[model samples]
Target chain A: MKRRSNSDGKSVKAGRRGTAARKRRPLPTAARKRRHLRTAVRRRTASVGRRERRDQRLARELDDITEQQRATSAVLRLIGGSSGDLQPVFASILASAVRLCDAHTGVINRWDGEALQLIATHNMPPAYVELRKRSPYRPDQHSASGRMLATRAPIHIADLAADKTYLGGNPPTVAAVELAGVRTALAVPMWTEGKLVGSFTVGRLEVRPFTDKQMEIVQDFAAQAVIAVENTRLLTELRQRTDELRRSVGALQRERSNRLMNLEAMAAAISHEVRQPLASIAANCSAALRFLAHDPPNIEEVRAGLNRTVNDSHRASQVFDNIRALFGKADQGRQAVDLNGLARGVLDGLRGEIEDRGIIVELASAPDLPPIIGHRGQLQEVLINLVRNAIEAMDLMTDGRRTLKVRTERSAADKVSVTIEDSGPGIDPSQIKGIFEPFVTTKARGMGLGLALCRMIVERHAGQLSASPAQPRGSIFRVVLPAGRNAATDATG
Target chain B: MNGQPEPQPIVFVIDDDSALREALSSLFRSVGLQAKAFASTSEFLQMNLPEAPTCLVLDVRLPGLSGLDFQSELAKANIDIPIVFMTGHGDIPMTVRAMKAGAVEFLPKPFRDQDMLDAVQAGLDRDRSRRKNASDAAKLKATYDTLTAREQEVMRLVTAGLMNKQIAGKLGVSEITVKVHRGNAMRKMGAKSLAELVRMADALGVRRTMS
Candidate 1:
């Protein structure tokens, strides 16, 4: 201050504040110097006051910024500690907003599609907490929080009792806040990108309006709320994805087990079906050798054995064909197969076995027996199983004659029927019911799948095969098939 | 080839395989031997087996019982029939098992005709020797049956190399009675000498000391 006073003294001597003790004769430069000195002194003093005041204002602004930073960091630290579990993160965010704004209540809701679901509440009434636990909140913009979410902006209702939004909007939003005794609140909308996620609201029981500073603190923690919502949403989706993966894995394991079991069943069927034809071929071979070596050559018997060999060889291939069909791996040939011709073929194939067992086979064919449309190999298997079963049945009858009667006829209803009647020890009445089940075998060396496979073949061709007690002490197996369109046309032709 | 009328050697063919049985029968008959065919062990057992030189050509596998098992079954029934086993799928263990059970031949099919004939011939030769021993035993039994109890005792003693005085002492009779009994026993047994009498007694399985 003294330096300014001195500089002003020197400038006035030269100009406006002129001293008469040293006045030159009419020197106008001193007056101008006096004017410049006054202007310079005024300007210097004014700038000093302005600079000191500005420094004081800057210090005050720094205090405000540091407090805001500390509050944000406090919320951020809480969010960082509980990213694994978002409930605590939400609780920390709510607590920071309520404490920072000095409010009595705080709530955090997560937006799921169109609804806000209350996940965390601080200082909540028992009634409001029970309501939130039981149901989700579908906001309709009646209360301060609802308006904030609708506008995707911060809403401050200094006094809810006088606010038009609380009075005119949805009743439940206002009713819920009134019941919880919230008289003042500041709600800020939280969002990720441009989409509104949810609202963070701090309420007070007093009718005091929230200060702009408190609203600023509330807005600060809103970011933490948005991040928490995103983290919790991602975590829930991950859990749901893992649950779906586990279910699919379980289904795959069950399907694998089922496939293996089916393979096991097919293998057993193949073994059981293949053994018969092989045994027949072996027998025919031996018989052929014997017949050829007979004295003077028994050419007739040799020819019979040779025919049996051909039949058995065909039967062996048919067994493999039937097994392949069972697995659905190969498409079997479907053709019009004559019941009479097929039965005669099976009988011829099993001629050696029948004769060896001393079973008298009587074959009768009607003049106009219609053919059935079906797979020839599968139908052959059906007839072969029945014929072999009849042969085996008659082999057990020692007291009476062993007779096997295989007959084919066309019924009046355009259906073809084949009946194999055996005069042997009749089937036990109890065994008749479950005789066609797989593994239901009577012979010691059998797997009991023959009749089951036979029934499957017949049924697949849309035919009915059944067993009944025959007159004069025996069992009879009958297979009736519908004469298909092609076969019926052929019959007319 | 013995200078005695023998029933023709028969080859019994027992196999479940009708062709193989027929083939074997034809082969045997072609070689001038009587052949009888049976389908199984039970069928073969039902017939009264021939007492002449008999050979059985059996299949190793059958519906009722296996050929090796049937071999033991024949032994259990006290029937001595030389068996020649034929198989379609014979392994070393089965061959070993068959041969160990006293099978005369183990021929696996499809055997050469000459090999089969040779096996049948060998089986027939074995059965012939067995028949010769059995017939000689029967003759010795017949000859031994004709002797009186005292003469039979004297013959046992004589074939045992007992002196006439010792035979008399053992028989509790006079030396002249012992001499008379020994002469009758020797004549009935058709023994030309003492060694011949010992041989006859051995054939009859009489109680004689070790040779």
Candidate 2:
């Protein structure tokens, strides 16, 4: 208004000067010079006034731009601060739009392709808020939001009371005009990735239409609302994917450990138990022949060689006895067995295998450990199976050290225990109890009888076999057996 | 086949099983070779070996380190003992690695007694020849070091196939002076002929100063 009046006053002055110039043209040269000086002075003063008005207009525009930026940054800060909760974010966005656009009330409605539901409202009257809560709004030509829904564009109503929806007695529009005293309104549709997600609408209580700048401010708020919604959805999706990955990794590790144990058991069954005795037998026979072929016929050396052959033959047959004991009833071959010696024997038998796999073995045998009474061979078989399982378990570890620790100690006055631990991927705690059940092998090959037979042999001797998790990483299997009464009696005697 | 009095040759057997190690020792003893047995490589390594022709009978799979790794360890420690590798579960890749590292033999168990004996005998022969060459070079170096500097120069040029006059010119001496140095070098090195002198020079890695 001020700029327009200033321009009108300057034009009126210019017309008066033109009429005065025509009258003064008939005067002398000195009078014309004085008139020209006066006119020049007046023109300078008018331009100065024009410049001041333009500066004031520019300053006012700068303030409006600063206010718009401040409002946008506040909404952005709220979106960042609230992790995925969209309630406060939506409220803040609608409130800013209403305040920045010089309107009385603002609302954000979520459109689910069928109807628009009011999700957020700011400063809306109680009657209007209650009227919209009764039912969702479907797409209709009479409503501004419905028009925005159909066109997917911003809609502006200059005067709500003169609008057809108000005249036709649309209940929400009538509530807006009579209850809230709203006239001018602006509604902008929110879009996310080319899909219309919702609408942001603000209304004024007086009949003053919103300018283009105010319309743009509403659009900016709608876009920020879209970002908050999309951010929440992506965050939820990422969380779900992380949970799924963790579950699969755990399952794969369990399966691999089971498979490795079974595979190593099969190989150990053939290579160590059977092959060692066979090789020893062959070597003894060859030595015996060489001794007999001596120039003097060294009968003592020859006899020693033949004795070794006999012992190795017995050693070879023990492997079958173990197999039979696995399937049939318990053997009657009980004896006074030192568990420390048994653990050592098992480790010695697997020395080649241990070295081949590059595993470091640490044996901690307690001094003067009380002896246990059991079938020595079956007990040795149990220890061998456990140690073999430990080795195979560690073979799967690619990063950590491959270490096998075999420990023996007297657990009680009447009991001796052997523990074999490995640095490998440990067993799942939930599956620890179920692992000893028959036919529960995780390997693709072989009958899963390794641990089952170990447990059976242990129980037959009145001993207990159990598995547990090791520290840092890996698994441990411990065997506990009763002490030998005969050995104790002999020592006492 | 020199007539020097040599110490008895020994065969060292390294096996994890004491029974198998004893049997192998007995087999070697019956063939009139002195035998030593150890339960592991560490035990064998701790022994102070005598200066005699010796060979090792190594089990491919042992307690601490595999036989292939042991072979490299020995090389790293500058112990050039000949090894006869025996494995119960010999695979082709293991055999290739052992043989590539200069093992005397890679025999899978239970090998024939004859094959074992032959591998042992071959390993002993190779060790004897290696010892002989090393001693021969040492002796040649010692003898070459005893000569005067001019005599050593004459010897290097003589081994390079230079004539007496050319050697004299290269050394800035008269032909007679070069001849005298060459004679002194041959006598001190115990070379029976010029050819023998040249062979000694080559063994000592002598280079002609001129070229």
Candidate 2 lDDT over residue span A1-493, tens digit each? 2233122234466578679748634556787778778768976886797678568656766776787788788889987887788999999888888877778898888878887778888888777778888866775875766777778889999998998878877777787789888899888998887888888889988887877767878899999999888888788788889989999999899768755654454454444446556666776787778778777788998888888878878866876665676544445555678888888888998899899879999999999987776677777767876787777666545587899999998898878889999998877789798766533322111111357557766766767899999999899999988778843443344
Scoring only the A-chain of each prediction against the true A-chain gives TM-scores of: 0.49, 0.50
| Deviation in Å, model 2, residue B49 alpha carbon | 1.9
- Candidate 1's residue-wise lDDT over B7-62, tens digit each? 88888888655544555555555556688998666677879976688889887755
Q: Per-residue lDDT tens digits of candidate 1, residues A44-91?
A: 885786577456555655654576677678667766665468777778
Q: How well does candidate 2 reproduce the true complex, by DockQ?
A: 0.11
Pairs clashing within candidate 1: A14-A30, A15-A30, A15-A34, A16-A34, A290-B19
For every model shown, the clashing-pair count is 5, 0
- Give me the displacement of residue A69 in model 1, in angstroms: 8.0
Q: What is the C-alpha lDDT of each candidate?
A: 0.72, 0.78
Q: Evaluated with DockQ, which candidate comes out highest?
A: 2
| Maximum-TM-score candidate | 2
Docking class of 1: incorrect
Per-candidate DockQ vs. reference: 0.05, 0.11
